[model samples]
Target: MDPYRRLVRPALFRLDPERTHEAAIALAERVGRRLPRAQIDPALEVTAMGLRFPSPIGLAAGFDKGARAVDAWAAVGFGFAEVGTVTPEPQAGNPRPRMFRLGSDHALINRLGFNNPGSVVVASRLAAARARGRVAIPIGVNVGKSRDTLAERAVHDYAAAVERLWPYADYVVVNVSSPNTPGLRDLQARSALGEILTAVLDVDVRSAEWSGEPRRPVLVKLAPDLSDEQVDAVTELALELELAGVVVSNTTLSRAGLRSPAAMTSEEGGLSGAPLRLRSTELVGRVARRAEGALAVVGVGGVSSARDAWDKLAAGASLVQLYTALVYEGPSLVRRINRELARMMRERGIERVADIRSAG
Candidate 1:
């Protein structure tokens, strides 16, 4: 008898998917202060990237692309929220009908192409939110190359975003793995990624010196489609660059074993949700194995329940995030997952989330 599943979802699902999402964001913006906050078990608190998260579960990037719902996300019980796949300049993004729902499989396909209100506007919104003291949790900004930027100039594009948005960002994620933007994933090449990250680090150093605040930790969001060697290389590069962590994966291009209609599945976009769970978890474990305690791993992709979150934690993810599942399971899913994670921890006599992989 979950209210969202039986009542809210049916009505929301009737609209086109993107429209439904727009409506959701609009509602969150309006009712954020009035919405009841979800409580987390004290035992679930996590320490990663030198910040304390009230819970280990976070809302992944792409949902709140413009930092519009920063307060709302914390009110809804997320330990932290990562906003944006924001670009240096604004663009309308790919044409309409870009997002599709796969109800049968509890998944989605989208080619939204990082449609956002650019860095300047988004930075303004974040500044406003912070000025009001409405921010309740750490907010990470995820930056992507502008669609019009040439591949050779990608480093400057990402560095510009980090430089512009760093003041408000508790952490930053260099997004080179989203498949929706052309030539985006190609930047994941070791040499190319190294250059981009190095430039971003340089920005971080300057920002810290200028503001007199601690340097914001930086992470890289990678794709789930990389080969084992590619994954290891990126993991090594993260350690070499002294990155705070890696977000182990954006959505995938793979469409294997789907129950959705052929027409829906045939749409050109990255796939997310249940179909991505196993592979994402596997990649997280791979990165963790390679990092060997040197880097934090933020696990994402297809987590719908507490068990799924636990699987990622046990696989070596220090923190976990969700997006597609929220589409299917609704907001209360966050509280339910955290509560269940606490119960599971109690049953196993574990104290903190970061110790999961080691305890296993």
Candidate 2:
């Protein structure tokens, strides 16, 4: 482990999780430009969802809520960055003290409730990034329903956000996961998910025509708490809809194996980070096995080290993403994880990252 894992992250963790996150973004924006281009081994490059990623390591959504720090994160060596779980209308999300750090478990529980500046503001920032040519790799926009959006009108809510942000995003994700959103996860029911995906993809096709570019790829993010039956249904829907892929297993509401104190345990929200590694990995593997190459799987949750990432890959993740680990491990963790991943790939005599998509 890097010395910062022991030294720097501990200090950062002492601060409130949300405040430290903002501070980290500010710092990255200041110094990210100076960081050299990440030296990723060619073997690590993989194209998925119609975009080329320098490596499999990506920053998951909910980290950059407003698409405000794309260049900063890209400079830090993430192969791809997903921003926002933006809603149709701007929202303050849950009240303060919504994010809590469980350092002992390398986990975090947050009820931020998609606190973002809404799709319009995020679209403007992304447009600016594109105009400035600041984005180095594919950037995905994850869209969700507004808290006030009724369940019956979910399609309209999602379509509105998709139409607004589609031009700026290399790909779009229909985030029906996120445990913090009431009635959100219910949308993952096969019938509900199908309607949402169909509506979003329809918008994507029209948006592409308007921009004179190929249709942007669309994927759905699922909750980790799903049953195998739900996973199977979602996998079928993906194939039926001809979606680009699936983002297996978002943060879980389940608090199993959390080693943090009882006070920390009392906080409500989805749990992510180290404590989630095993269950998330298992879910990824199951999805991969079930999907059977029908659609790509972007494995996320609890990926802290190269070994954890490799395990996810072996279990069937075409790409891997992390958010909570970055909180506990520091910015340098991205490069370190990629480098070690390359080494591990070499040790395994693998030529391409996708070659191990189901090594398990």
Candidate 3:
């Protein structure tokens, strides 16, 4: 009965991964227009970062970098959508052929850079979506430095994005974690991250004043390749900065257990999907244990099913994200997970998804 796996996926998988991704987004935008809003169970609701998401599952940022598919996420059943790893201006990103599929491993390695059409364009698109009454749920805007921006100047670059998209966003994410951009990961260090956070927090205050609105939440996303010491350091910094929360992980640089051919495995980019599930879940547990209720955690990287989502929540993730799974499992994955997750939650006598966070 699954048409995506039976027909759509077979055809999409036949093309190169990046182009297929583009086609998927275009298809989503078109399909989203005709689809009815996704139904949800109130028990699946999660309130975090000062907003209430109808479900704990969200679509990660890379899937809609330019905010071109705001309505598509809601139409497809995501409780929320985090869009853009957007920068100040448009860039071609790395050269083409940058995304590779590892069907044997159910994973993807992508070095797409932050190839968004820039913050202005993304903000405009989001604005239009809002005008049309399309944003049915919270939209988190993930902002990062431009590829050409130096480490020293990165703070201003991030500040610029938060300023540009501030009004429309339900929350903002500071992405110093993606490996595709040169020197981007270096910003995760204490001093560098402190500077960026300070500037971004200032920008939030400015946006609040400018719009006469409440200050929006700003959280940090970290690359999974960080050492324990580094992870602890970043965690401490997040707590110190009093951030809205932390997204426990971004794509990883590790290629430890991939079954894909060496050529595909050797590709330079962050690896996401099943291979990342365990490590990211552990990190979620670690960070959750470390934060000890001082901060919120959004678990991402490798969730695909109800059990996977359960693992993340039990490990202390208040919410979770899906990206690569959508590539392999199709759109129904979110709703299916929500349905099964609700069943699991009910068995435990819990009414809200938030109750299971760190339950184990």
RMSD of candidate 2 to true structure, Å? 1.4
Tens digit of per-residue lDDT, candidate 3, span 126-159:
9999999978989999999998888899999999
lDDT measured at residue 11 in model 2 versus the true structure, 0 to 100: 83
Please report, as a residue range, the 10-residue window in candidate 1 with the lowest summed lDDT. 31-40
lDDT of 1 by residue, 1-360 (tens): 899999999999999999999988988988885665667899999888899999989999999998887879877889999999889887789999999999998999999999999999999999998997878788999999988899999999999999999999999999999999999999999999999999999999999999999999899999999999999999999999999999998999999999988989999999999999999999999999889878889999999999999999999999999999999889889999999999988898898887777777
- Sorting all predicted structures by lDDT, with the top scorer first, yields 1, 3, 2
**Error of model 1, residue 69, in angstroms:** 0.9
Clashing pairs in 1: none
lDDT (C-alpha) at residue 141 in model 1: 99
Best by lDDT: 1
Q: Relative to the unseen true structure, what is the C-alpha lDDT of residue 146 in candidate 1, on a scale of 0 to 100? A: 89
The residue pairs that clash in candidate 3, if any, are: none
lDDT of 3 at 285: 87
Better of 1 and 2 by lDDT: 1
Best by TM-score: 1
The residue-by-residue lDDT of candidate 2 on 193-300, one tens digit each, is 889989999999888888799999899999989988888889888988889889977899898877788898889999998878888888888878877887789899
> Which candidate model has the greater TM-score, 1 or 2?
1
Ranking by TM-score: 1, 3, 2
Question: Each prediction's Cα RMSD?
Answer: 0.9, 1.4, 1.1
TM-score of candidate 2 relative to the true fold: 0.96
